[model samples]
Structure formats: C-alpha cells, structure tokens
Target: MKTEIRFTHQSLVENSKSGDRTAQYQLYELYVDAMYNVSMRFLGVKEDAEDIVQESFVDAFRNLDKFKYESSFGAWLKRIVINKSINHLKVKRLPLAAMDDNEYHLTNEDEHEYQNIDAMDIMKVKSGIEKLPYGYKQIINLYLLEGFDHNEISDVLGITTSTSKSQYHRAKKKLVEIINTL
Candidate 1:
C-alpha cells in the first residue's frame, strides 16, 4: 500500500524515464503550472520563477532515471524547484548576521497570541507573505506554506535547527502584523 501511494503517475514517469517524448510532454503539461507557482512563492519574481520552473523540469527529465519513487513525482519536482529558487536567492542575498541570536525563542504569551489569531483569509496572508522581506519570506514560505518542520528547513537553508525555529517564529509574528494591516 505504501508502494502504491509512492508510485503515483508511475506509468508516465516510467515512460518518460525511458525517453518517451509523449510521456515526458504529458508529465510536463501536468506539472508545469503547479511547479511555476511553487517557484513563484519563493522567488517572488515572474521571470525568475518561470526560468527556475523551466530549469527544474529540464533537470527532472534529465535525471528521471535516478527517481526511485520514494516520493510522488510532483513532490520530487517541487524539491528541485525549491532548491533552485533558494539557490537563486542565496546568490543575491546577504547573511543574517545583524540580528541578535537571543531573540530566537518565543515566549509562552507570544505562542498563545500566535495560536489565537483569527486569520481565516488565505489571500490576505498570501499578500502579506509577498510583502515580507526576503529572509522572513523564505522562512514563512518554507515553514508555513510548505509544511516543513524546523529540521527540514534547517537542512534546506543550511542553518541550525534552533535558528530555523527562531526565524520561523519571528517571521510568523511579522506576517501576523502584515495580515492585520491588510
């Protein structure tokens, strides 16, 4: 049963892995838009997102044989897109050394407030996320929207787990403020 779930779009993937043009084209058509959106959420630039999505598809197809189906094809492709987008950001961004490390932990009162926010509007949150600075935006996109835990975000961003945890809390606080004004 686990294998069955992992083998989503198996036939198309297998055919594409074997260099079947039609199968590859079908997979491209099925995933392109979703991949573009994922890239856009991180890159925040239309041209960069489009280029990254295109490169992701190319890399995915080129490395198709290496895909073992441990994850769904879409998930695998999304990872490539995310990695490329993050790398793109890293190239253009600076290190976060200016912030104090002690502010990493959230207090009980902050946690309670964070939990009680009445943010039922997805569009407002999305817009607020878009307005966030690059550092906060990356943390919010990775932790909240992508459902990544601190460990996974740390691994992806090459930061410590504690740093990831702190950054996410800080980013969420900023997001809440932005959402309120929206």
Candidate 2:
C-alpha cells in the first residue's frame, strides 16, 4: 500500500488565517522540519538554522493573513525560511565583493563538459558550491537550488538582472575551480 501524504499544514494554513490557534500550531509542527532543512542549506550551522526556522515560522504565523495561497503552503513557508536565513547571514556580515558591471562568463559548453560525471562527482560539485564565498553561495543557492531565474533573483537579492547573471557566472567559475582542485 502506498502511504498517504498528509497535507496537514496546507489545511491548517487555510484555517489559521481564520484565527484558529490549534490549526496554527499544527501548521507549525507540520512544516518545521522541512523549513529547518531549507535553513540548514543556507546557514550550514545547526543552531543558527534552527533559530531562523523558528523565526520564520513565527513570522509566517503572525502574518498568516498575508498568505494569498498563490503558491503551495510549503512554497510560501520556504520563502519565509529563505528570507530568515538571508537575514541571519546578514547579521554575520561576511565580506563580499562590491557589485560590478563587468560580467564573468560561464558557458553551456562548460556545464556540458561535466554532464557525464558520476553521482560522486555531482556530490563533489555540491560540496564545492557549499564552500564558495558568501555572496557566491547565496546566488548559487537561490539560482540553482531554489530554482529562481535571474529576474526573480534580482528582485529577491535587490540587484540588477545583469548583476544576478554576473554573480552566478562568478559563482559557477568558483565552483569549477573547486571541482578541478578536487
């Protein structure tokens, strides 16, 4: 028998907006683990990720009326989780290169060169992505992991579309360097 996929949070979110505390708590419980994983991907540190997760959920609950249900509840919560993660990182103030108009190029040709690599190789690439500098890692995670296009990333990161593209190029370049070193 196929196990049932529960949608407790999605249901609770609808009810929570109507001011149901129990439903709100259920929603919190249902999404907490997944949100924590999202935060972990960005923050990398356990305590910080947990803190962000808590804050995101609290914010989501408090602002429940703002949820229009355009996206899935998970997607909405994930956005909140990501925003909290970004804020957490901002508090750390990691050094980043200033935005420059000059672009760094990463071609489809380069990506294709690694397409035939094994799973271990793919994991290595992800590891390299994790090791990238703060700005590069954030851009890469938003673009690659979160599936945001350059236009959307520009809005989210408060940069130009060209800047988003440039950052991604630099991030990819740094990834390639890391992969080559391994």
TM-score of each: 0.89, 0.84
Candidate number of the best TM-score: 1
For residues 75-107, write the lDDT of model 1, one tens digit per residue: 999999998999999898734334665766788
- Model 1 off-target regions past 4 Å? 1-8, 94-100
lDDT of 2 by residue, 1-182 (tens): 97643546567787788888778777887788988888888888999998998888888878888888799888989998987788778778863457676745567887775554444377887789788988898888898888989998787777888888888877777777787888
- How good is model 2 by TM-score? 0.84
Shift of residue 125 alpha carbon in model 2, Å: 2.1
Worst ten-residue run, lDDT, model 2? Answer: 113-122
- Cα distance off (Å), candidate 1, residue 125: 1.2
Instruction: Candidate 1: give its CA RMSD in angstroms.
Output: 5.2
Candidate 2: C-alpha RMSD to true structure equals: 3.8
